[model samples]
Target: MNNTETPSFEEWVHYCFTQGYSDFHTEPDADHYEAHEQRRQRFVDIDPKALSEHIIRLFSNPAFLADEYTDQQIADAVWFIFGLATTYFLHLRSEVVPRNVQIRCIESVATLYTDLFDRLCDKHDVDPNKSSSKDTPLEDAVYMIWDMDCIEGAVMFPKHWPHLVDPGFRVLETILEKCRTVTCKESALHALGHIHMYHPERVEKIIDKFLASPDQPGVLREYALDAREGAVQ
Candidate 1:
């Protein structure tokens, strides 16, 4: 996210680290995504229970606790991850876990900071249950988590948060509202370049908002329009 010329595994892992999932660092790379069978093969090997349990321990462990991270940051990491782990484990798990011990473990961590995210969601009139809560569908909830208000507070303690970049275009395309403050505007602006396609009607309003807003840098504005207009011919 900070401006790297050539992307690499290390870079992607670092970006996702901010989002609090460094475990994905071990996932296969470009060679793995070259074909559908190759992609599906990766999923075939995972034992959701083992993977989920390992993830919980890694984030919870004090030593793996990023030295630069504040206790508050670490706490938020737990909260955000609890939600993600719940979503991925419960509904998305193709094979059900008999007991799902991971859910119980995640709930314990949720006690520390779910209240904070709930409050954040409240300010926006988004019901934690319906809008951005951990229980909400991940696709709809992403905007709430990556929101401008939440990002600074999260990344503040994680100076090395890099894993945050991998979800770029997919998240932006579905983000609820493109009308955002300067803080979030940059991310959406940057993500536009990576967009495959956007619904014409929905994107027009986003473009209008960008054009009307006074806060963006000139270059960002240029990219915004170019993104809407399809690569400047």
Candidate 2:
């Protein structure tokens, strides 16, 4: 892909969907790091607002299909874009993207999750509370709700813009209540902890529920315990 020319909406989605997925089982060598950096550099010139608009359009249109792509491929693409958006909003290129544009990108991510849940739960009649292989797009999307690296942004977005994160919080709560996957629930707990300072009571209530639940996974319970103490995971 050419770094100078901005990709069209379809082209952008296609590119993300096609990128080789890496599990990072071993430490990446110099060549791996260089290739990853080059992939990231390809998006430097694309306007954040435009990127977000395409994301919104891609998820909003039920008719705009990605049938050719496997669920795993689509999920991998979701991970890539979420990492890109979070990196821009919380780490690099904040000046270039602007606060409002960051908000727009966040809303796009929220929309992606919403659309995934609707398709998975409402349309396909899949149970959100049941644990699966977690290779599906919806499960993968849920795992990205929190930035485990402590660069959390979704729940903290409300620090500057209060009501903007309400929907996001609701989504996280729903995930915590209904998602049975240990890592996905852990991500939700950590994401909710980001706003513990502003809404301690609400966050505490959610964490308490998780802790009190029967047969809770050890790792997930540990995360909830940490969130109860307002510890960043």
Candidate 3:
């Protein structure tokens, strides 16, 4: 592609996976994060809805279906999508558009994210309903997206606004109930706490249940307590 030409969604995805951005950024080396943000700006002009659709289409592509790409590469690409989509919706929220219009645009992109999540699970053979301690690439990708989109992305809705983001409250509730991983639960609780002022009753009820559950680990309960304290503070 020429320098002046806008990279197609597929091209950008390929660049993200094949280039340096997909590599894990060990802390103290913030270059990877900066690289990701810089590359993401390349397609800032593309409609988020369109970009999300391109991601969905990627699963069925001949190259993706063939044994050409490793699971790690695919996971890395999807990770990039989560960050990019988050940027898009956050931008939408900041726009001067009517509230309903902003919600509509966000909903469209959010729905695509939900679709993309399911496709990744099915195609990559990761079971979203089951929690495992395994650090396999596909599993990590699925859970990361779940945490990023459903948990973090959900709480980011404007204060006192109804939960309109796809993969929002309902999905997070499911993750809390079904996913046995403590780290995942901690992240979910932390996110809920972050939004607690806007969703006090719901957040408190869920965290209360988690704290009361005998099966939950002590560390998780402590995290929950800290989250509650943070919320009130």
User: Relative to the true structure, how large is the alpha-carbon lDDT of every model?
Assistant: 0.37, 0.56, 0.51
Task: Estimate TM-scores for all models.
Answer: 0.30, 0.58, 0.52
**Candidate 1 residue 5 C-alpha distance from true site, Å:** 37
Per-residue lDDT for 1-233 in model 3, tens only? 43434567667556656653334343325655665555545554445445445544553242443255566776665465455543544444443544555444434433333333333333434343433323466546554553454325545554534435433555556556765554355445656666566666777777887777788766667667776655422
Q: Lowest-scoring 10 consecutive residues by lDDT in candidate 1?
A: 110-119
The TM-score, computed over Cα atoms with residue i paired to residue i, of candidate 1 is 0.30
Q: Please report the candidate that would top TM-score against the real structure.
A: 2
Worst 10 residues of 2 by lDDT: 117-126
The TM-score that candidate 3 achieves is 0.52
What is the Cα-based lDDT of residue 18 in candidate 3? Answer: 63
Q: Per-residue error at 105 for model 2, in Å?
A: 3.5
* Candidate closest to the true structure, highest lDDT: 2
Instruction: State the displacement of the C-alpha of residue 1, model 2, in Å, after optimal TM-score superposition.
Output: 11
**Which residue pairs collide, candidate 1?**
14-162, 14-163, 15-162, 15-163, 15-164, 16-162, 16-163, 16-164, 17-163
Pairs of colliding residues, candidate 3: none
Q: What would the per-residue lDDT of candidate 2 be over residues 134-166, giving only the tens digit for each residue? A: 445545464554653322555565655554466
Residue pairs in collision within model 2 = none
Error of 3 at 18 (Å): 3.7
Tell me how candidate 1 scores on lDDT. 0.37
